[model samples]
Target: MSLAALLDLRGEPALVVGGGAVALRRARTLLGAGLRVTVVAPDLHPDFAALPVRAERRPYLPADLNGQRVVVAATDSEAVNDAVTAGARAAGALVNHAGDATRGTLRFPAAVERGGVQVAVSTGRELPMLAQALRERIAALLPEPGTVDAWAARREEAVRLPGAAREGALDALRADIRSAFGLSAGGAV
Candidate 1:
């Protein structure tokens, strides 16, 4: 089973191999995660020109995987995606073949971000639609968007606790969050 964890992609480099809608979506997602994105494609959709990425208007080369923290194969061509997966494996980079999740090292889940919190739901590549539905359901439990400011304001006091005390503090925060969002102590709405 794939372990769930948050990766800090800020300022890290990643590659996306494609020029079409799938690649554009992946590129935007990566950018939103704060990764330095580079998109490789021979002919890009006009929308791609507006994105903040190093646009390599050419066929994806194996060398493009070198030093990348992550790589995504969003191309429609299965052969090209296979080549990208191999290159990424050799380079020790995590890869996601968006067209065929089972062929890649990782899968991207449907996610919802609210202020300082993020929830990601996955179905192990077996059911993306279910994951998306679950994400929407969880999103309904969140407080209003601006409440992150209240959590941020409490950050300094929260982090001052010792490591051993953090768990207890987190429990308290969880209770506070529950109260803020009208959730019961058992976490039901």
Candidate 2:
């Protein structure tokens, strides 16, 4: 079964077991999510220089997964990726295998974010192109980055109201959203 979830992995530690293009992409995404990522590979990719990651230009060690919250097995060798998967399992960390998604427990879905709001689409990693297309469509429909921020600021004041006052404020906010986003009175997004 596939479940799509938006996780707050900020300040968590993650490990990438490769230095190739796939691993580079995974590392960037992890960093973007505010993870403290460490990449281990025999030859660190030159592109990793710009990213804020602790790069170790050495072969992967099972102990590398010791304190990682998430792991990505993106090494070139299938056997090595399998080893990384085993290590992640032993360390009780979520693992994602780049070469074959089914072997790993986690799937990185197509995602878009504006302020604190995030939308993700996943086809169980079976049809990535479709997921990408859906993500693109959704991205185009999103409001500007600070639009959600502005709404959240208003929400902070609305929640402070007492009893029925709070309900009224919230109702107004809902109507504002519907008006701004061209949503129906039924509250469909």
Candidate 3:
């Protein structure tokens, strides 16, 4: 599923099952989106202690899944990760299992940010390596932040135009944006 389908995690209870670098990255991402995160792991990076998050220095337990909207399992131990995934699933919370996308309820995507727009791409556990590569290429081809703003500004005007005229106007705007970014015709970033 696309990240857009998930509800905004703001103010939601989220759990991370590790305190390592991988888990830290996930925690930072969730925190950036305004989730109330709780990290459960025996050890934590020193930098993590400075972050504004709840930390529990203990092995993960089923109780950790309580009241969580999302769960991320990034622990070093595969067995623990599996257990966390299972527990989160049993709780009906969306879960992302690091390095085990097939077993998790959701997979995080590499996102491209353009002004207020965020484009996220996923391979559905089929080709993550390819997805990463495509993400880099898409990042390179994305128009400047101003272009996105311009597009948003023109959206209302386009909607006011007649049907065919609207399509043509949007097409022209898309072409101009793509050309400004040096992208080929019919190729989307």
Candidate 4:
């Protein structure tokens, strides 16, 4: 079974071996996570230029996998994707095949961020569309970004409450969160 966990990618070097829409999407997500991303492709779509990533206009080289913590293969060519997977494994880096999960060991989940809370949904690569649908459903149940500061403030005060009142304070915080998000008391996202 594939285990689910959140990784800290800030400041880590990552390589993306494509310049198409799939590669662009993966690169954007990685860049958003603060990773130092370098994308290698013979030709790039115009949209890629807008992102803050190091773009190398060249064919992917196996050596490009070196020193990378993560590598994403989004090339259209199966041979090129295979080469990237092998190179990433040999270099001890995690590999993601954007076209198909069976080609690599890593896959990204659909993510939703709201009010300082982030939720990710994975269907084990069985159905990406379902994961995205689930993410959308969960996003609607989360508090808005503007409410995050208030939630944090409540948490801070609750953490300092006396032991006897701690649980009640925490429960009240949860109730507030539920009310703000239009979720039922038993709802979970």
Q: Pick the candidate with the highest TM-score.
A: 2
lDDT of 2 at 111: 90
Q: How does residue 15 of candidate 3 score in lDDT?
A: 97
What TM-score would every model get versus the actual structure?
0.84, 0.90, 0.81, 0.89
lDDT comparison, 1 vs 3, better candidate: 1
Residue 188 of model 3, lDDT score: 50
Q: Write the per-residue lDDT of candidate 1 for residues 1-189, one digit (tens) a residue.
A: 788888998999999999999999899999999999999999898998899999999998888998999999999899999999988988888899988988888788999998667999998867989999999999988767778777666655667878868766666777887787777877522
By TM-score: ranked, best first: 2, 4, 1, 3
- Residues 73-147, model 3: lDDT tens digits: 999999999999999999999999985888898777777776666667788667878878888888877666787
Q: Candidate 1 — which residues are off by over 4 angstroms?
A: 151-174, 181-183, 186-189
Residue-level lDDT of model 4, residues 1-189, one tens digit each, is 787888997999999999999999999999988999999999998999899999999999888998999999999998999999988988889899877788787889999997788999998857989999999999998766778888788889989989969778888888887877667887542
* Pairs that collide, model 1: none
Clash counts for all predictions: 0, 0, 0, 0
| CA lDDT for candidate 4 | 0.89
User: How much is 105 displaced in model 2, in angstroms?
Assistant: 1.6
